[model samples]
Target: MEIVNFTPVPALIGGALIGLSAAFLLWSQGRIAGISGIVGGLTKPVRGDLAWRAVFLIGLVLGGVLYRVLGFGVGVDHIQPVVSPTLLVLAGLLVGVGATIGAGCTSGHGICGLARRSPRSLVATLSFMGSGLVTVFVVRQLMGVGA
Candidate 1:
């Protein structure tokens, strides 16, 4: 339960930006900013629907790069991996499967769906948070992997 870096101001700003971007996407394009859906759409290209998805994904990557270049958040030197590449890859695959099964990722369910007062989103978000908490407990407390 120890916090390594607790920069509330930067965290707040970053969260606000995410919210704003999600809101803008919903307002402007009548779309939810669900990254998994966006990426999934890219995999099975459709007519007239490619541009915004590509741009959104690109913006995500470029936003991180811009943040790093501007030195606004945690630096590269401060980032230390707590897991092996293989484990990371496996975890990513699990997440992808979960997103597919659940119908949307956190951005879509937690942010956009919750904003719209959707019951399914509430359940999905709760499940996501509960699973995350259990995973952290198992990894840090039981396995002593990250500790």
Candidate 2:
């Protein structure tokens, strides 16, 4: 697919913010900013670990809301789901499985792991990118879906 309404500045700012937040989380909490791990930990509900995870998840939702409320054009205003809800749920589940098998999500492996120069993260990131590319090719080209 083709990229529509690509805005480099906004993308750059978003990336920088993500990086900063990840770094700060690591520095302060001594934890990886992996969304999957954070969420998964909640399932087990370790006594002392609950608060931070809940707050982090809340902050994630609030961040988007704040972005939209502040008139940031790059938030959710342009999001248009191209696939069915069933397909989206299937995709999310598959990603969750992949993250489980890979030992970490993209934020943990891609941003934090890469920054620490972990070879496993390198391979994991490559696999994630390759799988994404193949999926896009299959969905957009072979299946003739999405623009």
Candidate 3:
């Protein structure tokens, strides 16, 4: 399969959409569009609060599904990650653990928190970015673990 050529248009569009969504959520409901917080609220949901959270999570999943179904990105092909299954599972587990320990996922901290001028989220976002950079350096540059 061919690696897709890079372009800025789609990224800019996506970012604008995300910002608009966040702003709309804040304006309409006075709620931050943080995925982790929304999803987490589902676990011990209060009456009348569960519906929106479930809808948000479902919309998140359906976005990707819709994208693929409509022939965007990798089109209709089943696009698998380049990493091994074991590595993928481990990475997912690590992200979940980090989100739990850090009290928010990247979307919560990076997008919503930064927008709200949160110092803790700033720190968490920076640390996560740094960790990601180091991991990429070690995995790709040091270990030569890629296609």
Candidate 4:
């Protein structure tokens, strides 16, 4: 296995921000700020829920814009995976559907759910992580992909 030159600082900073945002959302809004729920609200929204979801999403975009303007330049040149665009899109769709069916995504289940000390969330997170590890092993080791 090749060593990865990952910089921990950026990851730590990102994790802190994510933790803060989740905590704030739970404290202020009395809601979990799951991205899927926020986006789903855009489609079939309740009366009071729509406005905040819209605001949250808009704030997300505005936050990105502000970061860029303030010279926190975005990382554009991400490493590419060895998969076709079509396959990636399909996989994303499947994951989205699975998350919806499973009641939450990794951010919601792994971060916020575990924060609340929910057993179901812990199981879901472990399953998700295990599946991801197995998938990566199969793809990189067995299939010789994305090397």
C-alpha lDDT (0 to 100) for residue 2 of candidate 2: 75
- TM-score for each predicted model, relative to the true structure: 0.90, 0.90, 0.84, 0.85
Query: Which residue pairs show backbone clashes in model 4?
Result: none
Off by over 4 Å in 2: 1-4, 73-75
lDDT tens digits, residue span 59-90, model 3: 88898888877778565476669799999999
Of 2 and 4, which scores higher on TM-score? Answer: 2
Question: Considering TM-score, which of the candidate structures 2 and 3 is the better prediction for this target?
Answer: 2
**What is candidate 1's CA lDDT for residue 99?**
93
lDDT of 4 by residue, 1-147 (tens): 666978899889988898899999999989897787677777776887688888998998987787678776656335465698987998889888878777788888999999889999899899889998998899888988766
- Assess candidate 4 and give its lDDT: 0.83
Location of the lowest summed lDDT over 10 successive residues in candidate 2: 71-80
Clashing pairs in 1: none
TM-score of 4: 0.85
Q: What is the Cα-based TM-score of model 2?
A: 0.90
What is the C-alpha local distance difference test score of each model?
A: 0.90, 0.90, 0.86, 0.83
On residues 18-121, what C-alpha lDDT tens digit does candidate 2 reach at each position? 99999999999999998888988897688898999999999999998888789876756678889989999999899888988898888988988999999999
lDDT for residue 52 in candidate 3, whole number 0-100: 86
